[model samples]
Target: MSTPVQLYIYDLSNGLAGQLSLMLTGRQIDGIWHTSIVVFGKEIFYGQGIMITQPGKSHHGSPLRIVDMGETAIDEDTFNEYLSAMREQYTADKYHPLEFNCNSFTNDCMGFLTGGSIPPYVTSLPSDFLSTSFGQALQPQIDALFTGRPPSGAPARITPSAATPDPALAASILQSVTAQATMGGPGPSNGILSMPPAPPVAPAPVPPAPSLPAPDASLVSPMHITTNPASFHNLLSSHRAVVAFFTSATCAPCRMIEPVFGELAKSKSKPDGGVGFAQIDLSVGLGGALAAEYQVHVTPTFLFFLDGSKTHELKGVNAPELRTQVDLLIYEAFPPHAHMSLSLSALEAIPLDPILFSQIPNLDTMFTKLAGFIDGVTAWNGAVTQAQVKQTLTRTVLPFLKASTATSPAQPPMASFDHWPTLTSSLIANLQLSELFPLVDIWRIALLNASFSAWNATKKVQEGPLNRFMDKALQAGDVPRNYLLTVLRMLANAFSNQVLAREVILFTRERVTKLLVDALLHDDVTVKNAAASLGFNIAAYLQKQRIDKVKARDDSQSAEENEEWETEIIVAILNAVERETNSEVTVHRLVACLGLLLRLSPYTAQVTSLLEALDAQRVLKGKLEKGGCREGGVGKKDVRRLILEVADKLCPDMAMAM
Candidate 1:
């Protein structure tokens, strides 16, 4: 008789991945899948190498779902021979979380047995994860774990009879029951093939642990009352570090330190910190049970839990001691990233704040420049309307700039200037590419006002005044150097306002990155410097988000979607760093940009690879050896110091070894 073959699908994530992957990865990943092939009344899977058990009776217990993989005519002896050959390729040490694992072996087996492949979702999962930014960022750590090391712990075993090893099998059965309770029964089953019963033997080795819940930053709140035992356990499980305050309703000491506790929660309550605070009143529901469980018999007692175990205790109303312990708890829970060990003082001093073009030009002279350009452009004959724009700038914008930019103790509020948007839009729409620079410079200063930038950012992407002007400049192609410099400076100023930073720079990063990359290669030194400033803004924004995500434990899509555009930007900066001979200022800014791109990047391997491919270390060493770069001048030491910092401190270990 032809034997039935089935694909047993187990969710190693226990269904949590389906619930959380969308929120965490910005993509809907159903599960961390593990699959095995069942044929000839035996279940086979690969983890610590190939292993077999009775059908649907492995340590995975019941599969999350099963698929009819069609029947295989291959006899038991031939199948066992195929398995023996497969074991050589799918050895314990050959396991990679992404590249080679259980699914890989099942797909191979399915191909041979039924001339079919594993479900595409099952097979494509790793590639899909590797495609995401978080995956790219985390690839280095994951790669390091499974690369060359021998698979540790228990080895694979074969169960010729219908049997499975103990405790592990029992636990797996319990887990399946729990999953069924929570997630409903297995996926639509096409009649499960039955096999002869056999005695349950010693338990199988423990399966790998599931991915944990992300330390919810929102949980880092003040010690709120948690009455239910299950809710309290969930709270502890959600955070890496937690503080529980035990108190009676009438305890005076608890009241004394209550404010202090609230303050501590407020101060240290950050998502990246992974610290949570809870209050348990001895007088209330389940509080007595929790107190008795942890052996807390006294009022106003504070218990600190680290990784779900009570590690320390304090019994007092002393605020200082409480503060000290909480600080220590947070420090222990979230250790600094390895990248923090580098000596990067020079690089650290490079300000991440936006470089603003806040220089207020002579309004009359600027207007004169614009009027002259307007008269010259045959395409723009709206001289009267253009004059009104100039009038509006002098009347409304000039005073706002003068007042807002003042150094007085109390500054006047920014005027509504409701007509400024209309006037600027009309001016931008009417002006030719050459005539746009003077008007753009005026708008650039206006962007320094929060109100103007807010209005600019909120407009439709294509309809924004800055967008319209930049589009014109991009379309014109061979623009004058002056226009490029002014436009670049305007972009730098856009970064000064958060709204513009998001909407203009970050939201339009593709177009802005392309423009900056091309401008970095411009022949004009001033334009290159301006482009470097804008590039610094982009890099700074990305790096800030990168660090914030690291600190907040945010695994969602980071600042840039993928490293392609960022790599393109970095390569352009590297080229700028290599080719520049005259200006150390340009070189300093370019090096800073490069440092920000590489520092704490999730793609350290990729960056190191790029640096090697471009021979960047040699180029930077050459810059260091250059006499002008080494020579004495204002901030020349900083220029040289930053170059060394980028080379010695920021380059990955692989690059350093090279």
Candidate 2:
């Protein structure tokens, strides 16, 4: 049977009086106030996080637009899984006004089930939001609101139960949920009509009768009460998400809801289990401090926490209310994985160089000057400062290229040189000034467009500027981390070409690989991020070089030398991935480069034997599984699937180990 998919779209601008907003000199509407995606026939709405509801009403108006996205791979089981997974990630604490929101969530779902994507226009709202002057002014407020800091500007006026929302604040509050939209349920994990996953708590010693007003102890997790305010506060902030219940021993409602709360906790059975159920007794010795901090005037209060921030609260004995929020807690607790499928290659791929370099007219002069000093950079004398390079590029390089582009769109100017030098005496003198960041940036761009093949190929001149740079970089004391970062990116760019990459690999005797790996673990985040991208470039060039090597080598006698070289590069990449701590994009890129290297070709057997000792999947599976199918951000899903796809090809029989 073909399962149908439905999309629901809501306009955030629905109730706003546009006439007043138009009267103002600044913003017209609060922001792009809309949300959507109808998957699996049900109106799958993800505002505060993913949820499902009957199609009778949408907060804006019953969907301004709906698209039938054909069929779903949606089995009832997978549908439930998607919702359960969606619920976990769509929680208020995890919601970012721009980065991860309803629109992003819908795209994730569409991509997972249909191998389809959300329209670019809808998904581009965050960037669009960021591009505006009003967005810029309101950003700190929006960022603060989502991240648990007090909102600064207009957002400061909004509250959890506001009847009407300011346009911009409303977008920030897009993930905000209301009791009316949700109604009462057992909780997020269980429904009044649907069964929840089984509880993970050990069974209570005594079983209660079905007629009992309270649940049997075995049915619920044991509740712990807080006695220490400082420690209690610390405890609450430590967990990614938690449920804190406030009760007074003398309060009748507190006693009444106690049993139901147990049943509520029992309903949680996610992999990491359900939300933590803890109580704060306002009647205890430290009650005053706790009560004052949270303003607990009533009994049976509940607070929802995700990522060390309290997102929502309720004061009541409503069992269904607690259950509904609990469902949200479960969803936030265990985010769903977007399973990447790679039958052959990625369904979506980014262009090799998505960023086009701008024109520079002084490129020819820059090259002439740089190449002149390649032979004796250390011996030569010259003024080395950021100004010289900037003045040179601004005066000569950029204008010439700009004129060329203006004159002939078909022929953009390229850097032509008999020899490509990474640095010169003039370059080295300036680079040593320690704070020359601007010069480094300009040099990087200049090198990016360099045509190394323009050199006299007949002489096969082997040396370049890096022959000098290695000494200077290795001897330098700690400088501003970006200085090294600029160098790393320049090196990475050099690795874009196979001929240059081969020469680099042999000349350094693999020290370049080691240097790149060292940078991956650098203390600065920028350096670490740069090093990650650098690894991708190296592996890409290596992949290309490997293809060429296979065509040229047919002899068995040189197997050891070939094995040693390829094995070193492969191990460096694997080690880089294993040590990678920051930037998940880096990890994905590194994995993609590895996948390219690992792809079995006509002559991979000789080098493949060397990698057999390594446990390829263990190092990578932990990262990919941890990612759990998130989309965008360096195409995490695509790279992950490609890794698996190539891994399967490389190790066809080691299915169990992988």
Candidate 3:
């Protein structure tokens, strides 16, 4: 009889690796992976050399993820014999974390029992880590740990044998095991090893959500240079709000408050469409013509415009009044969302950063897979096309990404990307949906660079490569789960750039909303997790807009879209919460999204009604009682806090009535 086999993946640093790797090692590593093999009701791993325990109950705690390695037809007796041999080869003294560690053992065991290999991302991590400068600097420490001497008072290290297993027997085992094994390599070669540290308090497996950078006023000059009448006219017509400082160089008062006006321009001008600042020198070129046109008779006169028409005026250097009127003008222009007044501390504390998939995969294999797909496209010459894509990935994309991941004080110079969008867009247009994931994943990783996303967002909606990819992936009736997951991740990473976020929320809202809602309800835990992430990104964007009191240039359209999708999103989250019983991470993400969607929403009454109708309190209460989000059979305090805030906002009277 065949026995089912599973690969349990854990993060040794818990989530600290993802949160700190970029700062420490100059890379965005998501996890420091540790793997173990499970079969015949026992979990087998090599740490202090070949330990056995109940699945997910080892000192490592629960796994971050589990992979199905297919069933092994090797009988229990034969598997035991294999383990007996493995025990001698994988002793405590022979362990080194990088050269030969748990992943190496699992790779060997899986090869023997099921003729399979673990995922490349797991196996290639050590090399990728060492590629960084900080990682290189730690080499002496790594060597010290792996030397023949064990820790003080510990037994001397044992040397592993470099013996080969029977090649013919391995081939026979491959035929006996399931046919899913795709890669081949020997296991348990002689190498140094060291035990992992006691696992840290477990958090989410991936990187912590990234906080959005506060808007920097230094991004634009303090005021527009109005050199001519036409230039002044253009400035007024272009901006939603304009505060033209009619000042003469000769006036001491104008000089005194000039700095104050510049400060205002920096703070209030960037949030929404921005308040335009123009200095009309009256003593300079065409300043007299512009001054006469606006009927400004005094030096240091402040004229405010809303939609190109003058609405308010102030004289002299009344700094306090300038501040007040600017705030008033912004409020009039954008109008804060109604729920912004409520006291919701829990929701406010939650970070509004984008959830990113920043782990570096095997770049060579990724390019090879993409090249294979390109080769099959009949419209292009395969070799020429592959060379083009390869040149971009090798010469520009990979090197730039590696440098950016460093802990450097300054950003690396960006390469010319004139060909990237066109090349990637053409691939999306031509490749089959099943074969498009590799390219999409490459794009997703690149989107982590703000410059890349900003450039992509500059493309017209029709010509945008990301838009084309989204349409192909989401619009296709039945996307493979892997492809869909990558697409969802790509959208989440899109939030790294504000322009991309605007395009996603404002331009592609409908299709993106449907994809998120459907994926949240997907049966697979991973798929549902990815969907929850995308949902969180959407909710975060909307909530930030509301909190900042910023609106799109077309306020009516943006507000109407928010109103349209508000209920649908809330309903999907509530349903997912009720259905989710396995993953605490997914549950937490869903709850966060729910809270973001509810807080500072314009349609408060409608959402409250919908939540009440859906019995949202009951659903959330039931989730709190479930086992996954609860470790050691107790609810997480953070999850419970979010639920309470969401429940209070939606069904305030439920507690009293109950």
* RMSD per model, one decimal: 18.6, 25.9, 39.6
Predicted candidate 1 versus true structure: per-residue lDDT over 151-215, tens digit per residue = 43221231111122232342343233222212211222422222221223333455433332232
Q: How close is candidate 3 to the true structure, as a TM-score?
A: 0.47
Candidate numbers, best TM-score first, in rank order: 1, 3, 2
Model 2 over residues 215-240: C-alpha lDDT tens digits? 21221232334433543554454345
TM-score of each: 0.52, 0.36, 0.47
Misplaced by over 4 Å in model 3 are 1-341, 376-386, 406-415, 475-477, 550-561, 626-634, 652-658
Model 3 Cα displacement at 446 (Å)?
A: 0.8
Q: Report the lDDT of model 2 for residue 430.
A: 43
lDDT over C-alpha atoms for residue 290 of model 3: 80
Residue 445 shift from truth in candidate 1, angstroms: 1.2
Strongest candidate by TM-score: 1
lDDT of each: 0.68, 0.51, 0.69
Q: Considering lDDT, which of the candidate structures 1 and 2 is the better prediction for this target?
A: 1
- Most lDDT-accurate candidate: 3
Residue range 435-550, candidate 3, lDDT tens digits:
98988887888888777887878866545766777777667478888888898898888888877888777777777877888889898899999989988988888777766654
Please report how far candidate 1 places residue 611 from its true position, in Å: 2.4
